[model samples]
Target: MPGTRTNPLRRLLVGRVQGVLNNRASGETPVVRSAHALYPPDSVIWRVHGDVTTMMIGGVTALLLQMLHPAALAGVWDHSTFRSDMLGRLRRTARFIAVTTYGERAAAEAAIEKVRSVHLGVNGVLPDGTPYAASDPKLLAWVHVCEVIGFLDAWIRYGERGMSLADQDTYVAQAGLVATALGCDPVPQTRAEAEALVAAFRPALTANARTREVARMVLTQPAPSLGFAPVQRMLMHAAVDLMPPWAKDLHGLHPSAIEVPVVRAGTMAIAQSLQWAFAGRATPRD
Candidate 1:
């Protein structure tokens, strides 16, 4: 049974559809090409970029909705002074991302450790089967830097109007750290190296089997109620409206725009597939 605290509509709004859509294209592309022609290097990079973009967009959209409707966030945004609290949270998140130096082994290790502690399973498996130990500050720093890049991309694509110049600089710095951790020059310097770095690290950046399992469980399990039924309904309505026409048709319902749903779904599927690969897994569960 659905948990009494869970909002069915909200669950549907932020459902597996998002993950499936984000990772679909790239996951399928190789198969499609294997049956026909060799997948071009350019195509692979494009697929990764596309998936990354989709993730940022989805995160941004969810963040915005949460901000607009505190109750929908399931206690993440339920304080009496939610807006101020949220601002503090965003600032801290940004600062965390802004501090890392690129290509620093210490930084990367530090970042990775921090991420492991959260155990969101986004990184898949650690180098060893053991839970990530935060002993190395460098790994933690690098991971934090990469996350900042992800968040920055999301901000530019979806929250550009609200971002400041400081945010852009911070993102650039984080990107530099990502480049450094991957053993590339501070910048890719050339398209080939850029492609190579991306190819090499793509597997490490996404959700792994363990992480996906965690996400799936979190999504499927019901959360406690916070008395925001109307707000939750509104978010659902907005998410549905944001879906593409193809999705609308698939779900047998019309939404605000058909294009967003279609693009978003396709993008998400690819992203999730990449995540699985990074985690060193064969494929994600349907």
Candidate 2:
């Protein structure tokens, strides 16, 4: 049943989501769905990336964590288009992840190479006059580790509470395939390693006006339209709720105890809806 053809509801939901990833008109192909992908379909990376709802929450948490580093913040403050078209920037990011995670291996490699080429032009001096480059392997590792922990934690919390430690490490290592291709040095191949790496970078992290402004825009950017406002708000809350306590402290986000359960339940509702919409469509082994 899991590999059966999609129904109308499935198509409808997917169409809306794909609309953001590709500028192609609805019903036009947005991303490739090769039976031959970068990873075998059974891989943990596929399961985590396939789930739309949790990935949205995880992505926000990753961005929030990433902005804490002044070097990371400097790159965004200098090069990002978030100030004018936040949604477009987010969609492009999502597209990159989707393409790398699910598209054919050649397509995935092309996407990674495109990013590498772009990084070539991204070097600049920070406010403190320290030179920074997106191509720096250490900086690439920071970005990769943040994303690995973010997606893994979000999947465990919202998608599979009973996921095993072995699987968690597997997820980290599986994601490292892409990281290595992108030239991220010291990519963590296990959850424990990922945790340790984040701690190692913590001393270098800080928050100032630039950090707050980026966080505010990331958290409060308007929905694609009014119809999506409530969904966006819940995702923002769930992301904050799932974010590590230390990160929340850095971002000055303190969710009340009363809001925690409410956010969890609402997010679960969204996750379930997504699960249903994707039912019988594809398998991890597809």
Give the best candidate by TM-score. Answer: 2
- Top candidate, metric lDDT: 2
User: Residue 151's C-alpha lDDT in candidate 2?
Assistant: 85
Name the TM-score of candidate 2. Answer: 0.92
lDDT of 2 by residue, 218-253 (tens): 999977756567878998999989888888998899
Per-residue accuracy of model 1 over 1-286 as CA lDDT, tens digit each: 2331165653443343334323343352211111111223233221222332333343333343222211122223222232434323433333233222211345436654564444332232234443332223333333333343344444343324365555455445435544454333334333333334434443344323433332233222221233423332333343434433433343343543565565444544444443433332111121
Candidate no. 1 TM-score: 0.30
Instruction: List residue ranges in candidate 2 displaced over 4 A.
Output: 1-12, 20-22, 25-28, 282-286
How do all models score by TM-score? 0.30, 0.92
